[model samples]
Target: MSDKLTPEKRSWNMSRIKGMDTKIEVEVRKYLFSKGYRFRKNDKRYPGKPDIVLPKYHVAIFVHGCFWHRHEGCKDATTPKTRTEFWLEKFDKNVKNDQIKQEKLKEMGWKVIVIWECELKKDFQRIMDRLEQEFKK
Candidate 1:
């Protein structure tokens, strides 16, 4: 299938897509704050610059968009029909980078947590509850 928007328009739209401080990231931050958990947002010291870092618990949280991170078995992880090869390669790189970053963080003695966008939309409370439990461990 062809792209509906003009090349320029598509470029603009893609440019507007944020890398940090995204809506989902904000929501997760708010939840943690409300629960009295303090955290650092996108600390450059960490690999991948995790969305939320709770130094107190030595935990790093990544709130990932299923599409961008290529969440396996997720419907949102659909590929763009216009650039199948390009998108696939880009997504593959993202997945590999994520794994590398998470492994590095783990080796540094930090507990890593990945929160999918779909999980937040489907069950915000449940995901937050699980996050709290991780802190307790």
Candidate 2:
């Protein structure tokens, strides 16, 4: 099936999608900041360039989009109507890469935190609760 958008339009739309400081990322950052959490954003020294890196706490937080990350059991992770095959391949790769990053971080003695977009919209309080616990630990 042909793409509905013109090639130029499609390119423009894709370009507008940012690689960092996305909505969910910013939201998490703001919340963490308000709670007196100091963090570095997208620190390249770490695997996956995690959205927030709290060196003092040895914690790296990743704010992932459900669709892009293929969040398991998340409603927003559904495949797009178009380019089903391509999306599947892309999402599978994303999941695999995420796992590798997490493992590397763990091996390096860092605690990894992944907050999905769907969870942000639904169980935000739960996310905070868990973060608080992690911080205490």
Scanning candidate 1 in windows of ten residues, the lowest lDDT window is: 79-88
Among all candidates shown, the one with the greatest lDDT: 1
Model 2: worst 10 consecutive residues (lDDT sum): 74-83
Q: Indicate the residue-level lDDT of 36 in model 2.
A: 93
Clashing pairs in 2: none
The per-prediction CA RMSD against the true structure, in angstroms, equals 0.6, 1.6
Candidate 1 local accuracy as lDDT?
0.96
| Backbone clashes, each candidate | 0, 0
In model 1, the clashing pairs are none
For residues 1-137, what per-residue lDDT tens digits would candidate 2 score against the true structure?
A: 67899989988998999989998789888999998999999999999999999999999999999888988887888887687899889989999999999999999999999888988888887898898789779
Per-residue CA lDDT of model 1 for 23-134, tens digit only, reads 9999999999998999999999999999999999999999999999998999999999987899999999999999999999999999999999999999999999999999
